[model samples]
Target: MPKPFKIPQSVLVVIYTPAWDVLLIRRTEADPSAPAFWQSVTGSKDTLDEPWEQTAAREVLEETGLDCTPGSALAPHLHDWGLENIYNIYPRWRHRYARGVTHNLERVFGVQVPDGSVVTLNPREHTDYQWLPYDAAADACFSPSNAEAILQLPHYAKQRLGTAA
Candidate 1:
């Protein structure tokens, strides 16, 4: 009963408002003494088979306290951009994964919130949060994958709302 290794699958959710204001959070640290890094809402799945969309919703709520209820007045406009990336896990953080697990498969999803939506941060998981313009948010991301994902937001926003983002 000693198995608690993490599943090497994750969701990278880009939470944005209709106006293209992307939410980015700075990680507290991989370790207490490590430097924090900026990323969108990301979390590994509870198990390998968990549906990617559910993981995305859970991570967003857990990290930011923002509810992404489906079909509500303030419902999250969730979209799957048909994007996924598989990358080697960073060595420093490998301890969280099972032995010899070297790569992570990340599915990208977007959530659209209304203007003036509330943001509540989980202080232990993230140090700070910002609602930045798409380009600026892309630039602030620490991981190349994260940056690339944010760069796609403008296009996704236009497609979703049929208007300027």
Candidate 2:
């Protein structure tokens, strides 16, 4: 039996520190011809009806081995940025979705982890991770949407800490 087609709806969680250092993970692509690039935690929902927050938490844990669930220590730091991005799925990856599914709707989120928090990348999905200032991280992202999201981190961080002017 073939696997079910993936849902085009997903979450992009920007894990960061209070000081504005953003975490960027290098994805491990199946095709060597496809260059690997840095991005925040991202994944599609397991079921069509899964809540966006739930998907965010799951992706965080799966990609970085961090617990962002409701009762976990990181839970209080998890935040929904109330932003969304719609973009065309790369032609090389559109095969994971159903036929004719060329676009994806991504919900944005942010999670603040301690400055020194250790990140363990999932070998299958990511090969490495790094912490960089928001501006630099944004420049490192290959996806325009992802880069834009990183560029918005300072504003989101300020808002989260009640420091937004």
Cα RMSD, model 1: 2.4
TM-score of 2: 0.95
lDDT, residue 33, model 2 = 73
The segments of candidate 2 whose C-alpha lies over 4 angstroms from its true place after superposition are 30-36
Worst 10 residues of 2 by lDDT: 27-36
Name the runs in model 1 displaced over 4 angstroms. 1-3, 30-36, 71-76, 162-165
User: Model 1, 22-50: lDDT tens per residue?
Assistant: 99898877555655577899999997778
* Candidate 2, residue 151: how far the Cα is off, in Å: 0.8
Q: What's the number of clashes in each of the models?
A: 0, 0
Evaluated at residue 111, the lDDT of candidate 2 is 97
Over 1-165, each residue of candidate 2 has an lDDT whose tens digit, in order, gives 999999999999999997889999998883567665889999999999999999999999999999999899999999999999999999989889999999999999999999899898999999888999999999988789999999998888889778963
Model 1 per-residue lDDT at 3:
63
